[model samples]
Target: MSGRIAHLADVRGGYALEADAVVVGSGAGGAMAAANLARAGMDVVVVEAGPQVRPDDMTRDGPAFLSKYYWEGGLRMLLGSGAYPTMSGRCLGGSTVVNSAIFFRLPDWVRQAWIDEAGLSGLAGPELDAAYDRIFTRLKVAPTPMHVMGRKNLVTRDVLDRVGVPNKPLPRAVDGCIGSGDCLTGCRQGAKQSVDRSVLPEAVDHGARVMTCSQVERILFEDGRAVGVEGDVVDLDGWQKVGRFSVRAPRVFLAAGALHTPVLMQRSGVRLGGRVGGTFAAHISGLALGILPDDVRPWEGATQGWGGFSPEVQGLKFEALWGPTALIAAEWGGLGRDLSQMLQDVRRAAMVVMVYRAKTKGSVRATRSGMPDARLWIPPEEIHVVARQVHKLTAAFLDMGAEYVFTGVKGLPDRIRTIDEASGLLSNRLRGRHMTMTANHVFCSCPMDARADHGVVDPEGRVHGVPGLWISDASVFPSPSAVNPQATVMALSDLISRRAADLSLLDA
Candidate 1:
């Protein structure tokens, strides 16, 4: 019934089809691992839950957005005592294809923290520096050019400077960006260099076979060793399939990212050191928007960031960002005429960013639909603090010429902007109640450490409980990265894949 062909009768029937290794997920981690292994002459088969969304086919705006970039067509949410809807990509390249390509290798502070506290080995200065260099060069990490700085970034920079925030241009994974600002809508120009166009292609070039629309339900073991895996191939959605298949490899790399990988292990009851999905978290993030008067062309240049982190006082980092005109217009939900005027002036929108210090009050639960659902608790106290911080930043933006200020409605400390008539807009526009929550940055699900008691996988990402089973993704982060996770994921996978290959050779 879905776009891909599958059979149910033959389900639960796959008997480890032969491959040198099976790499689960084709995002930054799996792609890099698969490519590296294949380059080492190993036959690597990559399994992806979402359908293959080629770089050539993506558009800035289309019906494809629901089915392509978003999980369950953007219907996923993070619910709990304090709930928030979170959207993530489900396509072949996973979230990497759809994320704002703010490239950041793990900062030295965080890397050292993992080594000292988390027991992860081999990521000291020179070691991590080389990996970082390789991954950044591959992704073409660079700052949003001055010409590409939209009004939002410009205004935010000016405002932040006035407030002594001292922001800088952020690095991103785009090539030949024409400042079309379609990075979120799918980079209409040849800007964003997601894994679909970068590492995955490299893997394919290195004799790796990537099978999209393939979901691995369970791993098949022979005796005490990992022999292969069995599962069904369904459409991108986790609908029932007609036929089934099994992929077999002596080694299996679980790189399904932070959310789904542990769910896969838990569903199979393959408890690895009893540490799967136990400690999951991500850097808490939110959005701040500013409305301007002149036409700023919201759809021009990179959509995510031009300005980067400023010195933080409350464990927060602020960047510059813009949304699709549709999202902006929707956020400008006014009663009648003012709404129309704002929508007409979509080009005049300026934006800023918010990042939070994450704590482990988060979790991922598998739903009946075979999808992993997330839940977050943003307390009223947290809201109050964040709101005050945002309000101050908004005042700064207004100081640098902003007509309107936008932060969520939950904790409105005060309305400080032009046109007291627009007092209600902040609460309305910045409400977490809106259907615009997202979760592109994922980390700290299956961690690596010196001991199995502390982490699920070893330093090389090999499962401590099961031999030949490994993890390589944001999931293996002992702690979350304050910045983007792409560079970190790639470098870790590169290290793990190389080591795994060496182990396989020795065993052979």
Candidate 2:
């Protein structure tokens, strides 16, 4: 599977590449679309804002990976009642490269809601099922084996079973995982099936050209139609401008993730009214920490292996999460001597994260410099819901034989010794500023809807009032997907590519 890849940092002068189709990203959506389009005999070129970090170059150091691959050096902040840190990858494979390898089909209920509320048709039928099947087979999605499950995972499963809560092993997109417990830092063992290691290679095999360090700053329009894109090539080391480049094509697809896609559209002067970057949403999450009696070594096995939805709390999902020693220490919540003592028990620490389907809506506005400034507002009712879920999670940890639990709230007690103690502290209404909240799954900026007033794109992903322009990313979701969105993003992109192929645009 040999293909051509250009490292723009090595180029000295301005350049231009011509193609039948130009994709402005190389992540899950862009990679899948490029692969399918090239396989259909279209000359495709993928322009990526980040440098290419090959599997061999991947490392196990958490901070190092975040510094190299994360957007804004992993310092992206969501401004609102409280400042919340948001993370998104900025590499050849995009967020999929730095995410936990979790895979889930778009739930049937979510599909139906799109059809009913957003006027999206054909998505609740065979079309979506077929797309899921194709992606499942390609990524070798499977559940983590018991042998590979770490102590933290086993504890979570046991506690859920004892408490009469339904639980199961999480499905992951991997082939030969050795479980270094560093999926977020990038799979150093090359076992996790990220797009850079999977579909992107297939696209390249089909003759799609990939240009790393090439940021598409604007879309090239001619006579009210998108014809190509232009941007500057930056040095991979210092991120300084090295040269300028452009790609001319008959068609262009925006596959950048939710945060950047809308910004790109605004910078390109493609106005789909105010809906282009409105109605932003995410799965707001709460973090809980537990102290175990024995050494669990949370960082030794599958990073996130056991999780399930709580029947007691609708729209709340519980999952296990493990981080590096440094991260664990920071979240341990103590100063000086107390923190030093907690660090000694870091090896025995385990964490459970609760993700709630938030009802609050947000927005993303492009700054004058073309960077995204995201503002998220969580209502009072939603804050209470998250607080209640956090209390339940803390109790579950105690029931699992943990010594004490730490609720990740800013102005609360550092540790809880019993369920009664947790109940007392959580009785007070939690506000957005006091609760430590963050989101990994973001969606619904440039949504797909039948009505032009409701969204920016139609059901087929074609942008309204613009021909030869399409958006196939998380940004096209009409609302927040209650689960992880990587698989859904890939499936939707595949559907968009197939539709584009049927249009005969490439034959022009």
Candidate 3:
């Protein structure tokens, strides 16, 4: 029997419910945890702050979708050396719904580092491998097929091949991707296997109840032990609090991502000596456009189907990027005529992006309005690192016989036509102020460590000093993953949640 789904309309004056466990944030981690616990026969309640949006309900309208489903209406940014946008979704299934569906397994070197340096011994054995297998199978993870890769991705593959750079099709959590090229807005075709469409429904089939439009404010405590959560039931249309709600449970799981998870912990009075919101890290990314002489119709391809890593570059990787025409044009800064011409020439545009793993840590705090205010400092050296990345991609395009490469670096020429020009342009003048940087994979705010004082959570994801409270999200990463975090997040959530279920049974 499928459990009930309660929306704002179903919630009256308020709601007071009880469950064996309550999971927050319905994204990758939360949905996975809920499914595991529910299958274990525990009564689970999944509370999400955003509305439940089905695939058919999704649209290609980027602005409208961002306003409704994204945090801070897609305007949330990191503040420090430069203002960099952090795109995180606020809808049910969270970022998995808006992400490009790319799946990269946790690197073996990163795993070894976790065991040796981070003291996460349990993450090494068959249990972690089993978790990866189950998730990969469940999501139907595979490489994007050639037919659906479209001309843009194919051209990128060709360019990398010609440059003697090893590249391949990106593995994605998708079943029947049509390459509509709007994965960021939302997958209207239901092809992308986001958690809401896969694991969350499986959880409901296991008799786990899902409560939408339910924003959890804080963890309820009884003598320093977590007992439940309390917050507002919000109206989705206006985003106004329509009623108050509470859920009493023996266990509470936090999967609210990196930015908001720290704020949530602080609000619940579970601050671990101000470490809850510190040590924030991210994979900072920037892009340069390759204006091809031939028409590639950038909008027709898979959003990001091909990518490569350079043997020379240690901390950065490259990918083919595309989106709505407006999003692509926004990368090129100009006046009316220039903008209009760029729009007209959109078909001749192919974008190459560089994602750099940030070395410096950042911080996240709750704003006066109770939203997450995140800040990260990109040092001048990292600025040069990003500039080097830009130089590489620009050079690749010039070698591919591109009509011109458009790099939006403030100090450089609008069109870089030669390798020498790009080298001289990006030699030393690039500063944080010259580029608009962004990151979607933000993590480590509530990092986990074996030592109690080193991080907010213990190795098992239990809050160091707060029993009955656990975090099963990227917030618990000891450090940056140096790749996309969704796969690692789900694997860790699976390990932690299954343990939680076993503990619940032992107590019973």
Please tell me which predicted candidate would have the highest lDDT against the true structure: 3
Model 2 Cα lDDT, one tens digit per residue, 1-508 = 3457777645536579899999999999999899889988899999998887766656666667777788887778887757787898888899888888799887777878889998988786677778888888889999988878889888777756654568899999988888788888788888889999999988899899899888778999999999999998877577788889999999999998888889998888875777888768888888778888889888888989998887876667778888566556645657877777776667788887878888877898889877888878888778777787777777777887788888778666677888877774465566788877667788898999999777899999999989999999999998877888999999889889988887332221
C-alpha RMSD (angstroms) for model 3: 2.5
Please provide, for model 1 over 231-308, each residue's C-alpha lDDT reduced to its tens digit, 9 standing for 90 to 100: 766644446563466788899999888888888877767666457777677655555566665777767656765555
Q: lDDT by residue for model 3 over 36-136, one digit each (tens)?
A: 89988999999998887766656777778778888888888888767888888888899999999888877787788778877899887788888888888
Model 3 CA lDDT for position 17? 94
**In model 3, where do residues sit more than 4 Å from their true spots?**
162-164, 503-508
Question: Where is the poorest 10-residue window by lDDT in model 3?
Answer: 499-508
Q: Model 1's lDDT to the true fold?
A: 0.68
Between candidates 1 and 2, name the one with more favorable lDDT.
2
**Candidate 1 ranges with C-alpha deviation above 4 Å:** 1-16, 54-57, 236-242, 272-274, 329-332, 335-338, 378-385, 411-437, 503-508
lDDT of 3 at 303: 93
| lDDT at position 197, candidate 1 | 80
lDDT by candidate, in order shown: 0.68, 0.83, 0.83
What TM-score goes with each of the models? Answer: 0.87, 0.95, 0.96
* Model 2 TM-score, 2 decimals: 0.95
Lowest summed-lDDT stretch of 10 residues in model 2? 499-508
